[model samples]
Target: MASSTASLISLQSRPSMAVARISTAKPVQGRSFLSFGLRAIPSRRLRVSCAAKTETVNKVCEIVKKQLALAPDVAVTGESKFSALGADSLDTVEIVMGLEEEFDISVEEDSAQNIATVQDAADLIEKLVEQKQKA
Candidate 1:
């Protein structure tokens, strides 16, 4: 009787594990469908804004290269991180100051600290510039 009971318990646990696997698999399918739906909806809006963002990113790359005193041969892009370009904390502060002067927008200390990449700084600059225009 004891052996029979243990076998039954194991059988019961196996089905639960199978159910858990099925549940997890289902959510993965649901998420992919949700993401596809989201992408289709935003494509038009994203294309419109992407053009302006690309221009901002290009300008930011130029500023980052100049601020870091990089050689002309060195390439800077939106994806380039400040630390990877040899910018320490002080260098980063100076870069922020340069961006402020170039963009004619004041960056809050907290917002400045969040800028780890040229893209980040460009996005923040654009946001601030937009806010200033609205005001």
Candidate 2:
């Protein structure tokens, strides 16, 4: 009768061990709350992504300044018009092409035609970068 009780206890203990093994195997299913909390945690990639954005913007600004023949000391706040810098249609085309090449992005002819200010160009470049990433 003692042996029978011992075996029963072992059987019960074995099930608990099996449960622990299963839970460890599938941690998400085992600790659903923990998984939920972990999923909400911010990722390191987010910081890198934001940094890349800042770099891209800075690069775009530099490219624009070079293409527009603007002095290095000049600020590119993105509000200056292409014509304001004495950029004719051909010069603007070259500028747009430079932007596309530097960013590895495409700017539609229609979109390019609509961009009037320096800020508009920067905004467009940023948008293009975001769109490419999503794709």
Q: CA lDDT, every prediction?
A: 0.71, 0.65
Write candidate 2's Cα lDDT for 1-135 as tens digits: 111111112124333321111111234534432111111222233211222355655776677779878887877754567788778999889889999998799999999998776667777888888899999
lDDT of 1 by residue, 70-109 (tens): 9999988877899999999998999999889988999999
Best prediction by TM-score:
1
How far is each candidate from the true structure, as Cα RMSD in Å? 13.6, 16.4
Q: Score every model by TM-score.
A: 0.62, 0.53
Clashing pairs in 1: none
